[model samples]
Target: MTEPAFLVLTALVDEPRHGYGVVREVEELSGGRVRLKIGTLYGVLDRLVADGLVELDREEIARGRLRRYYRLTEDGASALEAEAARLAANARSATERLAARSGRAKALGGLA
Candidate 1:
């Protein structure tokens, strides 16, 4: 899954959220690394809806604006879990290799 898609799915893990809510949650989840615009947010939502990963939970009118809330499906949660695991494994592999390289360099008095 793309980073945006993964973050979107993760944002919906706790509860349904409107478009703006999802945007904020995603930004927070990514530690401000991701700031989704309105257009991009909808595009990702549309794709997730089409893929059966997200569904419309409800619609509400707040301050004369319609808020369409979205929730993650079971499949979406599973997909997110798998993606997270994959990313973690990749990170671990890189960290291990970097540590080994550092150890070698240290043993070689910073020459390796």
Candidate 2:
């Protein structure tokens, strides 16, 4: 429901991924701004899984390591879209307010 959650969900939108994959994808998408710690990733994943947004979709053994893949459910996809729309709306409102303020300052003979 927040930035990290949204980022994680968005990363998972294209395909199912393990925890480390999700973390790496999010970091890359954010230009290395949102590097998630292991603990943080698991915590968020647990909450998402519990809420039925994400599920334990599959497990595979590769290179002798256990990799658990998570996939977003239909509800999860819908939720992510809703959150994205909400954030976009907020951003648009803020931009409008800033533009109005700038216009006021210019009208008052101040800097643009």
Candidate 3:
């Protein structure tokens, strides 16, 4: 998954939050990289909810026109954790491979 989706999932990792709250949390977490548009948010949310990553929780605070709460499922947490690990491992492996190649090239008096 992309960083925005990951950030959104990570935002819900702590507690249930409404749509706007989620957008804010994701922005905070990603340092303003992932701006969750209303339509985009719902689209991602629908997929995540359908995939059992998130669920509708209690409505703690609702404005007249907006949905105001959702929590991550246990499955969602697990999935997020797994994806994070996978991405980390992939990054490490790629770094190591590039480092080795760079070393080899440098030793051979060649550009990487």
Candidate 4:
């Protein structure tokens, strides 16, 4: 899954949210690393919905506009969990390699 998709899923893990709510939550969850524009967000939402990762929770009419709420489905939660595990494993590998490299550099420096 793409970063945006993963971030979106993370945002919805707690509860259902409207389009704008998802946008804000995603930005917060990512520590402002992801700021999703409405157009781009809808596109990703559409794909996720089609993939059965998300479902429409409900809709409301507010200020003369439809506010659609979406929630993560069971499959969505499973997919997100899998993705998180994958990312964690990759990060662990990178950190291990870096630690090893740092150890080698320190040993070489002490020898010289």
My TM-score estimates for the predictions, one after another, are 0.94, 0.91, 0.80, 0.96
In model 1, the worst 10-residue window by lDDT is 103-112
lDDT of 2 by residue, 56-101 (tens): 9899998999999999999999999999899899999999999999
lDDT of 1 by residue, 1-112 (tens): 8889999999999999999999999999999999999999999999999999999999999999898999999988888899999999999999999999998889899564
Between candidates 2 and 4, the TM-score winner? 4
Instruction: Find the 10 residues in a row with the least total lDDT in model 4.
Output: 25-34
- Please say which candidate is ahead in lDDT: 3 or 4: 4
Total clashing pairs for each candidate: 0, 0, 0, 0
TM-score of 2: 0.91
Candidate 3 positional error at 83, Å: 1.0
Candidate 4 error regions (>4 Å): none
Say which candidate scores most in TM-score: 4
Using TM-score as the yardstick, the better of models 1 and 3 is: 1
Model 1 stretches with alpha carbons more than 4 Å out:
110-112
lDDT of 4 by residue, 1-112 (tens): 9999999999999999999999999999989989999999999999999999999999999999999999999999999999999999999999999999999999999999
Give per-residue CA lDDT, model 3, range 27-70, as digits (tens).
Answer: 89878877889999988888888998899987663556656588
Alpha-carbon deviation at 98 in model 4, angstroms: 0.3
Among the numbered candidates, top lDDT falls to 4
Candidates' C-alpha lDDT: 0.94, 0.93, 0.86, 0.97
